[model samples]
Target: MEKMKPTLTVIMPAYNELKNLRGAFISATGALKIAGISDYEIIIITNTKRDGSHDGTPYVAEQIVKEDSRVRHIHNNSYVGLGFKFRQGIGDARKSFITWVPGDNENIEESVAGIFRHIGEADMITSYTSNTQVRKWKRRFVSRCFTEFCNLLFGLRLKYYNGICIYPTKLLQKVPTKSDNFAYMAEIIIYLVKSGVRYKEVPMEIKPTAISSSFKLKSVFEALGTIALLFWNIHFKRTRIKIGSIN
Candidate 1:
């Protein structure tokens, strides 16, 4: 039994994902239908290569967009940060609920189904990988550290922040930061939770993507810097002046 109650706008960030696009699209749509979501639009951000390589992504995006009215393409000829590309889609979203679905098949369609089921119950619905055994030891260690760090700092018992999430459009409009990197989503969650916004955690299984994870060392450092900046700005520097002056 499926009901068309809540609408959703799925923002998919695409790079050179020509190989994984078809399966990803199929799985997403199928899961949405299974979850009883009625009205939804999938926005594909077709980002070009920085070196002007022939990846056929824009052409693929064009073809896919033309075939399905529910699927739209945001073509970008130049390179940009993942956050900016996501923001481009986010800015163009036209639904009550919003979520970013990766173009690669790194996630299973079943996860999207879970989010849709719990979306209307809270302002934010987040998904974390229930089975960490599928990941490599190094990756698993890093993920655990990051999750613990977020919880300790924000006083939230959230398991993960880098995975799938569904957010209310109104709360996002009130969010303050617009980071253009891996730390952007974490900052979004932190900002909203600190403001007393409600959220729900949905555990789901993780799937391997067509391509292996390649987060560079530089990006990791940058993400850490963002975490520090956000922690200080929100908790210390910003909180100190709120409870009268400390002269």
Candidate 2:
């Protein structure tokens, strides 16, 4: 007569993160155990450049896979975008719920456990950072602008779009997200929200780290372009066909 706990697949994308991958994996495992999630798998997607540069991460990931049967490694010979890695994880996931934890170790065990504790309360568990002061002023400003712009463009008032969000595997697989950049997270959230999927926003605390690679000028431009394309496709190019309800 008790409700069953949902199984989870934790997608961890590592690109030249040999220093942080092991710690991230430890944190993920600890968090899952803290949340009392007995059924889970961690997929570590490691990437190396075509020229054989950045080779260390794949080796570490493979070692982790060998050490833990619950961990799987998906190696990319060439450097693909993060969005592509995310999609690959989604395709490989075999669980009731799916969420991503970056290999940079920015999300610690307690924060992840906080997010996991709220599972099954809604169709999706969307997280926002409670402490933005942990980041530099420029990064904080940019994040605020991005979130506001997304809200204005999509007419949704969500707290954050790029944080670790938990989605049902089946529901996420149906969304045709087209961004090969960081904007893909926003794209997925927008599509699901527009389709009337219920979501709950939770607050998470992030650890301070060096400037992220995604903060580069090129990535900013790429995200802008992707958002423009998403806007066009969502508003003008196609009709908003409703996916089946999660409820």
Residues 15-62, model 2: lDDT tens digits = 889899999999999999999998999999987775758949988998
Error of 2 at 69 (Å): 0.4
Flag regions of model 2 displaced more than 4 Å.
Answer: 238-241, 245-247
Which prediction has the highest TM-score against the true structure? 2
Q: Quote each prediction's TM-score.
A: 0.89, 0.96
What value of lDDT does candidate 2 attain over all alpha carbons? 0.89
- Displacement of residue 219 (Cα, Å) in model 2 is 0.7
Clashing pairs in 2: none
Tell me the deviation in Å of residue 23 in model 1: 1.2
Per-residue lDDT of candidate 1, residues 91-143 (tens digit): 88889888888877667787778777897777688888888888777777777
Which residue pairs overlap in candidate 1's backbone?
none
